[model samples]
Target chain A: MTLTDESPPMVNQAPSVPATQTVTLTVNGTAVELQLAPWTSLLDALREYMQLTGTKKGCDHGQCGACTVLVNGKRINSCLTLAIMQEGNSITTIEGLAQPEGLLPIQQAFIDHDAFQCGYCTPGQICSAVGLMNEGHAKTTDDIRELMSGNICRCGAYTNIVDAIQAVMHPQPDKL
Target chain B: MINFDYTRADGVTSAVRDRASELTAKFIAGGTNLIDLMKENVERPTRLIDINRLPLATITETEGGGLRLGALMTNADTAYDKQVSKRYPLLSQAILAGASAQLRNMATDGGNLMQRTRCYYFYDVATPCNKREPGSGCSAINGFNRIHAILGTEAGTPDRSIHCIATHPSDMCVALAALEAVVRVTGPDGDRTIPFAEFHRLPGNTPHIDNTLKDDELITAIDLPANGFSKNYAYLKLRDRTSYAFALVSVAAALEMEDGRITDARIALGG
Candidate 1:
């Protein structure tokens, strides 16, 4: 019932020196190498090591999805994952959701629907929305609510956020 | 937070070997629990051995007509897996009902089993929590103990001591208990298997102790037997909120009925 990753022991002793581990991962189509501590989270590594600050850190704990990212095409809370675990994996962040010239459909829809305010949780919200739209697990509002409940918006933008995602998923002819 | 050293382990063998020699070493996989504990200074490990890169992420079939779930399989993967959904629906539904989509995607099968309780007293260093500091006085016995355990209590134990009776916090484990899963552990000595019932120990008198895992031991995999009766199982979770919240009371039930007569029943509860 309990799910766990198969990682070796990383935290039973005190080390005399800081251990640096090398990791190679593809983020948003860019290959990057990072020298990180074994315990450094993917969120911390992305924000500190790679300097991709679009992924926000809300609860540090797994309760908030402000640090949501895509690993091997699956959405996950980056805060809960260690950077070392993502080696050789493909990662997609908020930065990867669009091209250099314009926004992705989800991002554009959020803009068109005015889906945010203060925007602290926007990056994570958009990322989670993208994952949900592509998940094929959600077919109704109930499913969407269940799937997107992890990403919380303090601005109370749930209505607009859901509307934006729905528009992208079920596009109207006039809107298109 | 204190500064600590870190090591990236290539596989489980090297990680366990390292832990056998280093007393301060601990395994770091999904940081869902370990990182939070470290940041709170509840668990201070100087050296963290990274085992996330090991080849243990797949869920495969065991030789004994059972399912072997790799230690690194994430909660989301297991919950949505076709095999798990068909054979062990309770396990799948329980995993989905507990954490949010994002957390489930990152939380691993092993880390979910190893998660500590969310006792407020245990987290508050200012208060006396035996689970946080063994032998320390308990403060929740007469305090806010509505969430404390009612089934397992030791006689002659002080009211304050009973504060540590918080039940196992994971919904996934509740289903595992009902499914009668087996945990496979790899240690310096060798590999060993423990039934799920014995895997998670009740607080009893020593509420501070969670499980029976040794210092250098690592959970390598979890194997679930083919219980034909489990096909008719279901997981029911009741929580304060509709989503992204822990369970208030959850039930994993497997019922076998012969023409409306209760032939067999397996049930596990978590609150």
Candidate 2:
């Protein structure tokens, strides 16, 4: 048998469909419009189209939380949602988390607690933590650990990550 | 993923009409599952009707003292809803037991019911999967069948020959079945309600057909009866990991007790 890159015959390929459509998204605080293909994921639209590469794509599928972003203040897997579907929603990526004056409290906490080794999963972890705080569900260390379990740290920086989030959730004056 | 035409449906009637008019059109709401399937080439809809704009994102109370969860309501919202957590704690617990927070935020209640199996072979296009392709034969039957269904197999039911062993992979649906929730749907034929137990089907001769939903039918809402078993209920999930993992075996159990004795019991399993 010869090697080929073709898909199976059962897969239906729509060739005559319109290639791309324009969608307006409110990222961080600014609204921008971009023309994108229907198959383009929100992750790709941010990384490739809008030139915002802060949101990492660890797994294009929803398995990895590396592409996690806040949509209207709720964290969602950007890889799972289509870019066109997210139109009119307010999206916040890691790049958008920091303010012009200084870094967000979570970012400073991550740095203070040494929450990262390779730093690939930090963005997602921090964004997920922000989303967790927004939801106001985590009340304890265990709650922080459970709520932030979506972002995986292959470097095994889980302990520091949890500490960083817990510190933010329940801040001690001395620690601060 | 294959390129497809995208159109936003302004209303439920137009959405149904568009879906019914086209054979390969699909409705997209919280595209957590459908997009995953599409990327894997397991699904190829020529046209996608974005149903996120539809007015099916509310949770209302029914006349029977039950709750009606709109189809577009996100799983996270549904689980965290005050009414659901108070009255339907079983459903809330089950929803929380599955998936990560990010996924729960994107997955809809209707999409959760429409979730496909997590069978390894079903996702591998290189392998022959009866669920992915009709009459293609099941690879999980004899190959690494650890996560396959333990009940409702061909060996267990002689009358209904099972062609596949894949199990429904939703933790929320397991609780819904135990609670006897009703699924309200709208189609070209009009509106109807499907009993939760009858919504999902066992993999029989045709494993490709996952649910009893007809073509062009759209799930409008899921109604939970007044009896939510909030006082006595449990959702247990065993998997490779505690979070962000598919369940190897899960159980949603509810009970009605009288004088510390079980009067009525309902249990549903998922994998």
Fnat, model 1, is: 0.56
Per-candidate TM-scores read 0.88, 0.95
> Where does the lowest 10-residue lDDT sum fall in candidate 1 chain B?
B154-163
Question: Native contacts retained per candidate?
Answer: 0.56, 0.65
Residue-level lDDT tens digits of model 2 in A1-176: 11122222343563664667678989998999898888889999999999899999998887769999999999998999989898889999999988899998889999999999999988999899889988888888777777888888999989999888887777642222
Model 2 lDDT tens row, B177-232:
99999999999989999999999976666677789998799999999998889999
lDDT of 2: 0.87
Q: Write the per-residue lDDT of candidate 1 for residues A1-176, one digit (tens) a residue.
A: 11123222334444355567777878999999888766678899999999999999999877778999988777888887777777789999998888888888889889999999989899999989877766667777788889999999998988899888887777642222
Strongest candidate by TM-score: 2
Q: What's the CA error at residue B198 for candidate 1, in Å?
A: 0.6
Clashes of each: 28, 0
